[model samples]
Target chain A: MLASLGRGRLLACAALTVLVSGCATPAFDQARALHHAGDSAAGLSVLISAQDTIPERDQLLLLLEQGTLELFDGQSSAAARQFVSAADYIDAEDRISLRDEARALVTSEATTRYTGEYAEQLLAHSHAMLGFLLSGQAESAAVEARRAGKRLREHEDTLDSATFTRALMALSFEMAGQTNDAYVSARALPAGTWPATAARLAQQLGSSDADTLAPSALNNALASARGELVLAVATGQVSTKYSSHLNNGLAWQIAFPAYRPVDAPTPALSLQLANGKTPAHERASTNINQLLRQSLDARAGALLARQSLRLSAKHNLAKELRAKDELGAQLLAIALFVSEVADTRGWYSLPARFDLYRVAVPVGADSLTATVRGKSYTVDLNALDYSRGPVLRLMKF
Target chain B: MFRSLSRSLALAAAFASLALAGCAATTRAIDPGSDIQYDAQYSFSDKNAIVKDLTDSLLNRAAYSADQAPIMVVYDVVNETSEHISTSGITDDIRIALLQSGRYRFISREQRANLKAELQEQGAAAQRVASARKLGAQFILAGSLRSIEKEQPKQWRLNRKKLVYYSLNLEMTDIQTGEIRWADKAEIARESSQPIIGW
Candidate 1:
């Protein structure tokens, strides 16, 4: 009788563990499906509803998704607010608690919270600052620029240096009429010729005493770049898969995004300027997919350990279930094997690559057409009056 | 044995049901002056410390004494930080502290719009004649809040630390001559660190 009762409790515990296996939640995929179906409003609603269920550690992922949706819908202020919330959450370091760690030991990494990768955290602030800039809040944008700079500096030794963030900071400074600060920021861009161009601009603005402002082709072309043409491309998807490897006599099952192909072709973006000159599309300074892959590789060991813990828990639970009822245990084990999923929660709406093109909007050039995959977006140069300073137009697909 | 097993089953079912039912959250009022949680990149303590330092400097100024109160007007405090912070909250704290000290008199800009409406109404009304006169501020207080963040990456898989520094500068400009009479600065610095994870 005592043995029977013991088996009964074990069965109950097994059932509970099976229920807890759904730690990553299914809302992410549901939202993604909705987004792919062109129902972004529905996708945003799904994410907002899932916010309460997502662990604090993983809440930034949901916030980033919501921000991206808002940005796509042209609600820059709302997008900025959501991204700011995500930045604060990432900075707070309040994702996992002692209770959560204990749960991971009993369950799996699905139960363990997901604090974002360093690259995602930095990108959060970049998107937030961009939203602020689009909404005409220069002071708030400046603040985000500082945060992005600090984040990038932290990852200086890594291949995660974001040159576009530096360029954005320079643009912010130039818009605020701080030519000296702008020059310093522009000089840090990844462009090989920007340093000389920046120095020339500094001298022209009377902020530097450089001897000569040479008339180089790039410098001469950039001199009249009153308006900025931002061309962003969302190419390919970031998907996670469950992988297993043998380590220390145990088969360790882990969930992570697969490595991005190094030889992936860059998507083409065609620009038709009013001056009848088309600028060739350049690759983004930092490839986001490559950066994310590198960041995950750096912490592969830790991630695998967490995944192994969850797999072990599932195994223990299945063994206990088998001891109670053989047939029930067999069915549950099969279900676990089939239903075990990877946590692929990330900002899927973010562009795989963020490309920027400078347009020398000669006076009387009223509009410019940016074509991506046969879809064209027209920018009214007059609407973004460059008399005050250079204006930014974010074109994303 | 059968009876005991039945009783245990009933108890187990009750416990499982209770566990499945999540608890309801409750709300309560908390003291505003209590020590705030140090989780945010920016916290209430940072603002509170800045306010205290700035107010202390103002109180110590030789130009204004406890006996003679100085009349001042506070324009809006500009937030130059990337994070959305309430700059007015800091100014409100300073205003409250100064008013409590009784060494400074403030002309409320919040009342200006209402005052203008009241004067116009008096002009339209035949019976009531309100004066359009207003008190001139002896000094205008305006300032900007700025922040700088620095981070030291994990070295040799040991420690990771992030340092953030904030500077609040307030200048008291004489309204009459436009000469800056007094300037005070409040600075706050914080450092947070975490142990290395992977060996």
Candidate 2:
């Protein structure tokens, strides 16, 4: 009996050590650091290699990061394929798995499959739209727009209106000649936050809002230009979630997920056109960090309730073991404490914010240079065919 | 004590064998025509139903000369749905059905580029081959696929319900006159319910 108890204690200590060490480092930390260092190709390679080693439950997170890196690397078609696979997986795993939930109650929330936050789900479609647009598949981009609109409507009651997605949807619909749908999406844009191009489009489609009817030089240039160029710039890294532990004086403690704020400055962008023309206007479109914080705030009540229940469950198990063997109870308590970790997984490759710029190009203009954070990136207009629709370019800093 | 230890080892081995057997993968074949609703998203059965309905409609309603088969070209079938569907698959099946029925003649859309390249190569080589003549298509067949999906509102419920409606619209137009000679649409609406709790 003594030898058996020793063996059991050794196994328990080993399991506890594994659980504690696993929570020491958050997922995607290395890849995110590499991406922030301006080597997105290396970051993408890390994720692609990890696909063989990571658990199947984490595949959605891997795909989201891989898709973002691929998009930044100018592999638009490959990025689109990744987003499509992610969307399909999200659809297939729509239901909550009871088995995983039960296991999570005893273990940690990390044991459950990462189904993705609502913001991530919506952004998947948004990124897919950009992917298709960048690849010159305007019709496929329109399809993604429709899908994002559906998801937005489903969560409108809880989620703040995604202004950036709505702008892209309107542009996609206009490019596809779905005038009525474009007007609808344009109308959905919040007042005072609508981009200049979206407001002009709404007004052109006969919007009754007085704000949209105001005439401006930018709108006039946009209306008269032979083609328009849309530039989207992403800057800074989003704040990461960390495990926060709360302990009482007794043998009771709980772990919850919390965000460590990141300081990301607004990027300044200036365009120098070959024809000496300037961009019509620029605006900050989406703040992903803010969205993430709001989503976590909304779930605070449920998370607290679950943590309370887990504490009670662990305490009861320990008490029952104590009635049988005091040493066993103590060992179980130590193991439970180590295993109670918070789920801090997320789509970490997303930028802190997105900014949009609209430039009107004359028929013969061939190139332009955009300077962000003192680094100039040139876009060659001669290589792109603008007769189809507006040309989109993405720059990351 | 030795006897008890041996019995314990035997029990452990049996349990391990049972767990391994449970993890083994198995495969079987099933009829393709059977309706299998795995989820609310589209499936192979939906494709078959749409193809069958649309092809039947086209074959029965097409207006053409009784003695001469209409020479046609299958153009782009645009996908306007939320899901990524290969619209070409639908058009390919329709072309096959029309040809097998002996009611329509199709100019190969996929082989056009290869044929053009082959003709260029022959011309460059100056080979003594018969002159290749390209046939002109009289009618163009084109279509679009669209879908609408709705989910049950978030509330206290044991199951979530989703409804998806898909429509495929096809038309045959006279290339010279720019007139639509035949048009038809096939629609499929399905509602699926998933349990909120399962083990």
Candidate 3:
């Protein structure tokens, strides 16, 4: 009887270890470590290999990381493919899982499938469109931009319009000689810090001719006169998982993913226009951390319920075990404690913020230098294959 | 021993109850014209109602439905929606409802091949069909589906709702005069909220 009890305790410990540790793919950590160690090539290899092991639910996350890494490596074609696949996967109804809900209520979010946060979904679509744009496939980029716009309107409720996406679309329309359509797209730009250029483009199109124009309209008209240069900036780490305790009148404290943030270094960019003029860029877009905060707040109540239920179950199970074997009861308590660790599994490769900057360039200016993190990235307008005129440039730093 | 066994039985019963409660599934057939499925980006009932409403507007207009039924061709229904929606399906529904109302004679774009073949096979030299000008559509029905989605401010998981607004705009134009004879729009709004963990 004693031997049997010991075996049960050992099995419980094993189960708890598996439950808590397997929440995140082991390969993700390995790939991240490689990237941090300045071996992105090897990190790419790790992610590629991890595909076979990733569950269908988390496949979107894998694709997102791979796409971003490929973009960083200047393999725009490969990155575009990954982003397209990720976008397609997200569009399909395959991610919805009714079964995971029950498990989530009984255990924690780690037990449920992680169908990425809304921000991540929008960002993935944007990145895919960016890939197509960078690969000089403006037509494909235009289609993706439309799809992303539709998805953003359908899924995200935040006041933020997808400025980067609209900018890409405007550039695409401008290149295709669909200036009217480009003007319409630019006009849709929300009057904000990031969309000032788009508003200005609309004004240049003569859509806003009022003397006392909206600030956005004025900016749009001015930008239309001189060629506009757009810089998309990615900085810092997105949120990371830490434990947040909720006192739900339970015997055990529940540790959920509500803790410390993993911050990435944010760098300011300096632009040197091809016309020998260096202009200071203004912030025109969002950092997307607000989205992360909203997603977490949305999940808080449900997470608390799950945490409370899990603790209550543990308490009951421990009591039951104590009546049978003291050693088994103690082992179960330890197992519960171990399993209570927060599920920090997420797309840790995501940048802390995605911001946009635009500056006016002269007609003769065909290149520019974007300095970020003390390194220079050249935007060669002349070298870029634009069907009409270069309207926007995407650079990763 | 009796008390311990009872305790075990009670625990099992509680678990069984929880399991059964979680497994409860109920379903019923609904009137297709009014049924709304959860997570539907666009509902069939909304489409059906839009078609009926638009058809009514056209029928109410004496200019569109003259003493003799006006000959109208359904030109196109543009899917200006973000998603890949088959606008033709909605147009077909509109066509059927319009025909049943006896408001107009419908010229089929799909049947043009058959019409051409019949016209050619029966021409037989004396028919004088080879040089005849193509019959133009008298009035044309054209429409577009436009959608805008709004999300409520983020709240707790149980309270977050995504609201999608869809507007179906239709117009009948006098092709010869290039003037719109009838125009109408139908609007649908649907709100969806997700459970804590599901997609």
Candidate 4:
């Protein structure tokens, strides 16, 4: 009986190991070792083998490494493929987040003293992107160009961040002889809030031209934009201490579309977006002041403006996406759409030097997701007309 | 001892009577063993190139065309050799290529796998509206590896010699239309000069 029991146990143990022989094993170290040894060939082989052995996440990491190597090895098309393969392994949310973080790093200012409090911490990032672009390697230019664009896009987003946009707004206020501690703020604006406002405007003027937008609506939008800007560009102490710019009760006016692009000669508000390669001191000369005005004019519609009422809203991208009609729907679904995001920050000039300020964060690369009747869907809220008056106006087609 | 042996025989006979079934390899006319097996190894140079080329073809085909709304096509190479090839090895390559194109984005495996799981768990509700299949990748690639065998006998003090041959066949086909859009075959042949070798 004892012998039989022992035999049975032995058989069970043997069976278990054999069954689990096909189970996953860790391969990260081996892949790393091979890759570092300059044996990309061996490293890739091990990676392929380990995809069958390692956890799914490791496989993603390996693919990321492969893409990095390909990019470094002057095979960008190959590199792009590797990145896509890695993307395939991760969730959409994670993909977007990681890519977004990477993008942020690209545009992030270096640890140099742009202000006393904010050292140019993201300088390495600037160098990295520029290195790729300047490498003079032909095969890798496409990959490098993509990186450059990411940094530029992120720089433009400073006009959207809690620190930068607010500061710019403060500059505007300061230049206009107003007291301010810059603070930028952002609140999730639900789609339900816009339709009624839009309907009211649509009612005010049955056929208002693009230039004839209502002063009341324009003021509300401007006040909101200024409020948001105050929070976006300032620093810690300044953000909390600054006086807010958010206001209400504007005089009435009409708003309509203007500057039909694709038919128009060019993007009306084209600004030289800094790709993090530009010096901080050079920023003021290149601020989106010109771009912002064009954006306002184009978005507000000349027809509304011709009526002598300024249309005050950060609706540049939103208007553009909508103008594209059916073709733009997909893009609109992904962009950030909000009347404004408001916050505040401290001003850090070089070191031991600081001041309070306020800013407004604009919606860029922002988006909206909604659930109705147990169904999940998202819309590019920024793509919607700000004055449509809150009622979830969906795709026309 | 005799009784024990007798019992074993009796049990075997009982099992035999239960219509025990089996399978076999058979042929009617031609010699069935046309396949000759051989293994080949290449230096680091060849290994690197092979993976790169194969991956490029696979990824470019999958991403640019398959994920498009209207759907377009490109060619891919398929491996049909007995080396236990996985599409992921190559498809992973394809994914990287497409993402870098700046012109295309890939449908990630995570996305596809999640869709599969969601569909399974939620049963139709999960797969509604968004589908990875929306990217129109209509073509798939495939290929095979084969070898040839030859032998020679006696030269001076040497007794015999053996040779092994290899060939790789690659093809791309329209998954929906069942058409072979393109085909190409590359072969690697080797003649081993072995002295005093026979099998």
Candidate 5:
């Protein structure tokens, strides 16, 4: 009887191990690999094919990744659709689910629905804005810009101001012929964030600036240009979270997810006209890596406190079972340890930094050359239907 | 002792499995007019209410002769709100209600393209007949939807509250005279609270 009981306990332990391991498998490894290999189309295909395999809990992350790949694949309309779906899901899931939270505390955070980090949520709106602008839906783009601003305001206490989204909002308002609204957005931009562009836009929108009173040639060109060409280039990959183990001389070790250190310099992209006249270079408008770090930092205290509570609960349970049955206690301890794996899943396909370049294009100007990371690529402005408003072109590396 | 331990282990395992499995999803039909609100965001109740109120206001308030229904074209309702609301839905509902009341007439904006295509296909023959058959709208119906949302500031609280107010202002303009003849607005305001901590 003793031997059979021991065998039964071992079998139960094995079964628990299998269940935990199945849930711990990362969902986006294959998709991320294909995306980083410069095959976003293939990456998008993999995600679509694996839709059934992806748990409902990870649907938000999947949508975000698919949207990014779609945008990179030059399917802006399709990308916009995906982002809209994501936004809908986010809106519907705005309230926390008690059931999911309960399950997360007992099992793993991965078991809960991925509501999305604050940065990811804001970027969803920003990307949707870009997708609509590129597809010549200026009205839809303006709506997304307002949505992004609303989200920023909702989380103003926790998140830093997103300069990229603010700039896009100003530009979208301008395209939609809401000049007063556009001026409001432009003036709201933080000082020294987009110095030249903001000043020029504010000045053009009738914001009298003593500093910009002198009429420079660039100002004249911008004032008389037929349309503006906006280039957004994404460079380098954002850092990923990994499982971190902590052994504090306790019976059970604590495991949590931590972001890997990313120390790369901000990347820049410069645009030059067909006549070899280089426009003023602007600093990177957004640093997603920093945003991710700040988001994680903001939640660190909560995460650690939850982990501590979980440790105590598991330890107490194991200690009680040890007094009743030695073999069962051992089996339970093993099961708990295996199930303690961190939830490191996240939107891994995002770029580390975003560089935006805006320049006024004269009539009949078809294309311009963009130089980034010692490589030059010709961007076609004529392909876009600029009659609606300013045209946008995106590049990823 | 071993039996009790086995029972205890089984109970714990069952609890863990239940937590992991979660509750299965279920769906049931409810009355469309039911005022059920899940959050501060817009809901179907709001849509239903707006359509009913606006349709009633337009039908009762507009100055028109009972001899004949005024010819009108329902233009686009610009969505200036943050949400991706299909303002067309509101316009479509209002149009349906007005037509059913037999108090108004509407020219289909979507069918205009088909009408143009048919005229082009028929060349000169259709144009000769179209000039006499073409109906000109006397009033143009247009509007815009806007919203103002306010969120509770982050603080040490057990619940977070959000308030959203939506205003849909619609108007009828005299096409020839370029004068606003009628206007009305429907508004919805809702507040929702969500618990910060969940079991």
Candidate 6:
């Protein structure tokens, strides 16, 4: 009996070692422990060490975890590389467990069916982030965005929600001080594309997700897109709306009058006190024009100083498109509000100038016969125009 | 002994949770409240002729396809915002607006496609890419906005101050010889939450 027991003990020892090393090893536990213990680097190291023992494919989960942590600390480019690499390794159809969990949290009913790509969804998150960043850099960023947009439109059917989001983000970024992200989303937003992200959200808020958006949501989206159309059409700024100087050196030397509210449709919310073109003050060596021209450089410096293009843990807006639960409602509200203005406002006008105009009309029986900058033309209903020299009949209504 | 081990594991898990909690406590969280504090403005699809007029002018700005000479373009822009947004947003927006304008035609993929044939012929294509006499883009225009923070009491809320102010600048540039072709500037300001003084 003692001999048999001894043999059993030896087998048990071997089995235990195999079991620990096979699936959940000591190092794996250590990594999880570190991840929980506020030492992500240590966790990463432990995870990386375990890679030699397991399949490289298994490391995808570990890479994703590490990449997420890296992104939160503002390492977007690095995080992107990690994510792209993981994508290259895995099939697009493989369900991401983490993403699945997030999706589950949003749904109220039992989820019996789910299909699609999580990586693509993550790409949307990335695109939205980049779009948000680009919105802040409306000038230089427009070129690449325009190129990307044209590419996305040609393959729209094949593009997923995330890719669509990227294209839209590009559209949104260009729509500074205006209406929805779609107004100027493309250096070449397509001729007939109508984005429904905001409308979808509004619809989800008011109706069941199983059905299409409520008419109200569609109306809201349509209205927002119209706001974009106003900027595209009225401003005559195909490539540029505001002067560099206007953007910088904004030290308005308005004889500082308390702003008189223009009683218009979208009544001017501006105080009108400091809307002066002249600077309140400037260095003697720098004229206001020169000061303003050089302001983007200063603004760039300030931007660099103030914010880093890192990921956020709590506000994972990039991942929100996949997270079905009206996740970006607040953000969507903010973004939609911004998109409307960016699409309608002239770049040469102040951002607040966008507040003055209430609505625009075709000035004719057809939708295409509107006047801008003094010229008239017929166009499709969905056309977005941001060029110059067309006449716009100023409607004070 | 097993019970004792379970108790120890519970303590370890609690201790682990504490470390994560501590790290998060030190980091500053982005303010989620300020996300929706802005106003909404709108436009209409019911209006079409207006959209056409707006786009046509934009196309006129980008019409660099005269067949007789190359177009020249230079990148110029302004930073008029407190937030680090890209001017490309507006510029690209302008480009799209122009594409739909119908009156103007920019150099298309076909024109660039001829570059290889040009290179096969000699450095002539390279030179054309550099000259306004041979390329597609005539000029590049760009700009930005500047805003300042103003702390004023909220009109609707008690004792709460609102922050506001925004401004803009724009410029056009000649691609060849890098000259400032034309420039313009404008400003707009907004105030949210005026003082409900008596409160």
lDDT of each: 0.64, 0.75, 0.64, 0.32, 0.75, 0.35
What DockQ results do all the predictions give, each relative to the true complex? 0.19, 0.34, 0.11, 0.01, 0.28, 0.02
lDDT of 6 by residue, A242-341 (tens): 2111111221110100122233322211111122221111000101122122323323442232222111211243234324434333343233222111
| DockQ, prediction 2 | 0.34
Kindly report which residue pairs in candidate 2 clash with one another. Answer: none
lDDT of 4 by residue, A191-243 (tens): 22222223333443353421343334323443443122111110111011121
Of all true interface contacts, what fraction is found in model 5? 0.46
Question: Could you report the Cα RMSD, in angstroms, for every candidate shown?
Answer: 8.3, 6.1, 10.0, 32.1, 6.6, 28.7
Candidate topping DockQ: 2
Q: How would you class the docking of model 3?
A: incorrect
Docking class of 4: incorrect
Clash number for each model: 2, 0, 13, 117, 0, 100
Instruction: Pick the winner on lDDT between candidates 3 and 5.
Output: 5
TM-score of chain A of each: 0.78, 0.88, 0.78, 0.22, 0.87, 0.26
Query: Proportion of native contacts found in each model?
Result: 0.31, 0.63, 0.20, 0.00, 0.46, 0.03
Model 6 per-residue lDDT at A381: 31
Better of 2 and 6 by TM-score: 2
Deviation in angstroms for A334 in model 4? 93
lDDT for position B8 in model 5? 100
Q: What's each prediction's TM-score? A: 0.71, 0.85, 0.62, 0.19, 0.81, 0.25
Model 1 residue A79 lDDT score: 93
Model 2 residue runs over 4 Å out of place are A1-14, A17-27, A192-219, A223-226, A274-277, A281-284, A363-366, B1-36, B110-135
lDDT of 6 at A31: 58
- TM-score pick, better of 4 and 6: 6
Error of 5 at B92 (Å): 2.0
